[model samples]
Structures are given as structure tokens and as C-alpha cells.
Target chain A: MSGEPANREPVDLAAKLASFGEHWSPRVVAGFNGHDVMVVKVQGEFVWHSHPETDDFFFVLKGRLTIRMREGDVTLLPGQLFVVPKGVEHCPVAEEETHLLLIEPAGTPNTGDPATAATKHAI
Target chain B: MSGEPANREPVDLAAKLASFGEHWSPRVVAGFNGHDVMVVKVQGEFVWHSHPETDDFFFVLKGRLTIRMREGDVTLLPGQLFVVPKGVEHCPVAEEETHLLLIEPAGTPNTGDPATAATKHAI
Candidate 1:
């Protein structure tokens, strides 16, 4: 191989999700570089937040969700992806149960502003 | 938001594989940089070959597989990943059946040294 230690392989989202039940909170599923990848099941709405130094990337593995941006909204369906540019305030809402892949720096706050108790480090 | 156009998002291997039925051959599911991300169903033995200028990364999405290399063999199970470094002559054999994610530069040969008829560009 690349002479590098193999990381976690063949990740199964279904199995991972089966291990927990929660909303908003995410669990670390994998890591690459200095970033953490988290998988979360979301419904309803998340708090509006902004990561000053980090960009957020989300992939909708299942269901439907919308990223509400200050200037516009990006509605995502399965196989669709969108990135919220750094410093942009946004909120995510799920019309139904959704499975998503969220990528950001390892320490990124679930709540961009982190001014409330709902902000979590589930990852 | 990296100020870049969004490409395909939130890929689901199951859905992609559902659209095709084949073995060894891969179908392009996504692209990043100059690389193509493919999903493949593989069983039995593959050819021994090498890509002098490219590295290949594999993630076992399901099942088990063994990479036979001149130096040593790397056996992979689900949730384990391995990268075949550039210029290594290796073959993959699945004792049972397997589903895998293969990432490599666009146009990389399926049979690395390519002197065969089974070689394909299903992606």
C-alpha cells in the first residue's frame, strides 16, 4: 500500500447510525488530514452559525435537507452536495429524517456562534 | 464554499451499483481534481499489474478482499482501506464477494499494464 497505516475502511452508515439515536449531535465516523467527518441524523432545524476560519461541506446521503444561507438557500437531495463558504451564516433544516455527511475542521462547533447549550462536540 | 461549482454530492454506493451489473469493471460515480471515484463489484482473482505513474486507493464497502503484492499481501475487510503505492505490481482477489470504492486518476487502466482484453473503462 501507500506505506501508510490504513484508516477505517468500508464505512457503513447504516451500521453506524444503528449504534446511536440523536438529533443535531454528530458522531465521528472518520478523519482525514486535520479534519473530522461526522455523520448525523437530522430533522427540524439546526441553529444558525458561522465558522470564521473553516468552510463546511455537506453531502446528503439520504433524504432531503436545506442549507439556509443569508443570501440564498441551497436545497439538497440525495447525491447532491453544497458547501457553505467560510464566515457565512447558515442553518440546516430537514423536512424529514435525513442522513448526512458533514466535513469541517476537527474542532468546529455544531453551533457556529456556540452561544447556547445545544452546541455539541459529539464528534 | 470554496468559490467553486458544486459537483455531485452525497454519493450512495447502493444506488449507483443498482444502476449497473458487472464485475471487476467500475462505473464513475464522482470526480474530484483529475481523479474519478468508482464503485465496483469484484470477486475471484484480478490481473497482476502496475501503474508506473499512479497510486490506487481502495475502500472495502462490503465483503473481504486480498491484495497480492510481491512484497506482502494486505487482506481487507469492510471499513478498512488501503492504498497501493505507485509502481507496485499487485492483483486483487476476493475469497467471497466484495463491494469496493476505487479512487485513481482519470484514465488509469483497470489492468494496470493493460495488455489484455478484459481491461475496461466502465467509468
Candidate 2:
């Protein structure tokens, strides 16, 4: 993953998504301005959690993704994005396999709590 | 552009791109964690410049884009992205009409220099 200069090439989303298949395990594809650009695959419901310090950004790349919040549910398809504001408890669910691109502050845990967050690694 | 709660609904990239047709003028579609998610229609070559304080992000939504830099040129297509690191001079060019989604720190000027930057407004 680390070879050419970080800013020297383009990051192909489709190619990055194809490099992994593990559900819920996000792979860092790029970074910018103190944020990590990650791609993850999901098939079931994720934990209901909230990032107390940072907003969560989600862009659906394949299949359907529904982000359930206390206020309501926001369902997104390909080419759509939704941001879950900080401190809002939410869970993501996908009936079928789904792919996503997420942007969050660098080192932000996936589960909001460091103790329960999935281990993130660069692809 | 301000309507329902900012985080309550999804932002459709295609729909947002269709809502505007001005070249190089980016419309703010969403914001999170001090960054603005913008969409812009671009054609021709842009001024060569560099953001001294922050990195610049570019995601191609339609057509093609070529980011020219001192080191080399990186061309991108739909579903592809490239990040121009802070302090790196770059210029974006698109032979045909192109659509893009960009991420940058809130209030960052498009032209690097505030005096000549396009006045960015929310769509």
C-alpha cells in the first residue's frame, strides 16, 4: 500500500473495494487533512454507537445501507452520502452485501468506544 | 439548500450535480467535521495553485479529469479520487464537461488565493 508518493497517484475506489471482502473490517485507502478515507463491506447490523467528538460520513458504493438513528432512518444507495452528526447514536444495517466509503477523523474508532472498535488497518 | 436537518437526509451526488452547470463554481452540498462536501462542474484548465494550509480532495463523478502537477499528471475517471497534498502546486483540467465532488477545510479558497478565488456558496 505504501510505495509511490501518497499524492502522486489516483486512488481507484472500485479497485480498492475489490482488494478485500471481509465484512465490517474497514481498510484505509487514503488519508487527507487529518482524516482517513476507508472502505468497508457489511452484511448485517452494526453496533448502535456515537462518536462524541467527530461526525461520521458514509458514502454507499454498492448495495443498500440504512443508518438507523433515534430520530429516524436514512437509507442510502449508490452515489448517495449521509453524515451522522457527533453524539447521535446510530446503527448501520444492510440486508445484503454492501460496500461503503467512510471519512472520519484519523484514529476514530468504528464502535465509538475504543474497547469495542474493530481493528482498522491499511490495505 | 438548507432545509431538513443537515444530517437527517442523504445527499444525492447526481442530483446535486444536475442542479448546477457553472464551470469551476463549487456548490456546498454538505458539511461535517469542519470540512465542506462540494460538487462542481468543471471544463477547461484551472489556475495552477497550491493550498498552503490544507490538502485538497477530488472525486470524479462524471466524465474525466486530469490533475497536473510538477511531478507528473494524474488522470481520473468516474469513481476515482486523488488528493493533492498541502503545499503541492497542482492544476485540474477537463477536456469535456466534468462533474466532481470535493472535500476541503471549511472556508478554504478554491484558487488558493482568497483575492481571486471563486465565491463559494451553498446550493
Candidate 3:
């Protein structure tokens, strides 16, 4: 939260989540400074990856999320958060459909690498 | 989410919120880069002030929060978030006991001023 607020646009998390209908794809809801607050619906599993330049913030909104890492696995329920450091290989898996709020650098991709299939895409 | 995640220590939002007992005072639950993630149980109204250097991120976890500013007031419900840009005077008011997750620069005082009573405190 280090940006200008001349043009304020309040975001309704519930409404924003309702408009999106895809899993593993994040929709940008808001931005502050150089970070973007995104929401994504995830199921099954996502490929293992890491953001070499920035950290990843994950807050579970619905259901549960398991973040697998070489060291161990992190399980997050609603109202829980886990931050995976930059350059740490990890994979996110969900037993069921899970809604998550992610805070990261604006251009960060789900799979970390820009050339990966999970790279930048539609909001 | 721009900090290094080495020596990661995940946080349980629900548990941290439960461990705190004061209102208007923030308890630091996590730190990333030069920022801190805090959880506070807020009730009543807070002082009006502005952080000249860094913006403030507010995510309501329970009940409701009304962030009063010169232009207008922003209402946030559970799962909703709002960012007050740096240098913008704002006051936080809650109708009842409300739980909140705050993201801001580390050592940031709740009053935006270091000399205020709401300045840095023990977690």
C-alpha cells in the first residue's frame, strides 16, 4: 500500500470472485505500490515453480490448500496464510476447489517462469 | 510480497487473532521485507492521521470496518480489502468488535506518528 489514491475504486471480494469462472487463473482485484492483490480458484494441482524475483503470499478464502515444498508441505485453511520465499521450488495442490487471495509483484506468474504455460494471461 | 522467504514461519490468522486482546493496537504476526503483517481486534473509532511514507492495507476478517477519509468512507466486509494511499488522512471505525489483518511497513505506528500513544508496542 504505497501508491497514489487519487482515483479510488473499492473492490468487493465476493462480487469479484463471482465474476470469474476458471481454476488456476488469477483475476487482479486491486493494486498497491508494485504489488497486485489477486484471487484465483484452484483445484487439483499446479505445477512446481518459484518466483525468482519476488515472494508469494497465499491466504485461503475457501476450502483448503496444500503447498508442497522440498522441505515440507504447508496446509492452509480459511484464515491462514503461508509465504513462500523467492526461488523456492513449490507446488500448490488442493483436494477440492479452493479460493485463494494472492499478494505478489504485479507481473508475477502462477508458474514463476514467464515462458511456462501458467505464465501471464487474461486477468 | 517482495521479501525473501528464507527461514519461513507461517502464520495462523485465526490463532493470532485469538491471542491478541486489545483494540486499536496492532500485534505483529509476520514480517516480510520491510513490512509487517498484523492482526488487531478493533472496536470504536481510531484517530485520524496519515502515513507520509507508506500506504496501509486493510483486510476485514470479521464484522465490518468503515474507513473514513476526507473524500468518502469505504466499507469493508469479511474477505474484502481496501488500501489507503500514503499521505491520505484516514480514520478507522468499527460498529462492533471487528477483526482485521493489516499490511504495512514495519515499525509503522497505528497513529502514523511515532510519539502517539498508539505507537510501537509489544506483540
> DockQ of all candidates, in order?
0.15, 0.47, 0.42
**In terms of docking quality, how is candidate 1 classified?**
incorrect
lDDT of 1 by residue, B1-123 (tens): 324333324456677777766788788766544556688889999888877676677767778988888777888787555667677777899988799877666777778755562443443
Better of 1 and 3 by DockQ: 3
Largest DockQ belongs to which candidate? 2
Cα shift from native, residue B21, model 1 (Å)? 15
**Higher TM-score: candidate 1 or 3?**
3
> Local error of candidate 3 at A8, Å?
5.3
What lDDT tens digits, residue by residue, belong to model 1 across residues A53-73? 766767676789888876677
Q: Order of all candidates by DockQ, from best down to worst? A: 2, 3, 1
Clashing pairs in 2: none
Better of 1 and 2 by lDDT: 2
Would you list the rank order by lDDT, best first? 2, 3, 1
Candidate 3 collision pairs: none
Write down the worst ten-residue block by lDDT for model 1 chain A. Answer: A1-10
TM-score of 3: 0.89
Q: Write the per-residue lDDT of candidate 2 for residues A1-123, one digit (tens) a residue.
A: 112344667899889888888899998888888899999999999999888888889999999999998778999999999988888888999999999999989999999999999988897
CAPRI docking class of candidate 2: acceptable
Q: Estimate TM-scores for all models.
A: 0.55, 0.95, 0.89
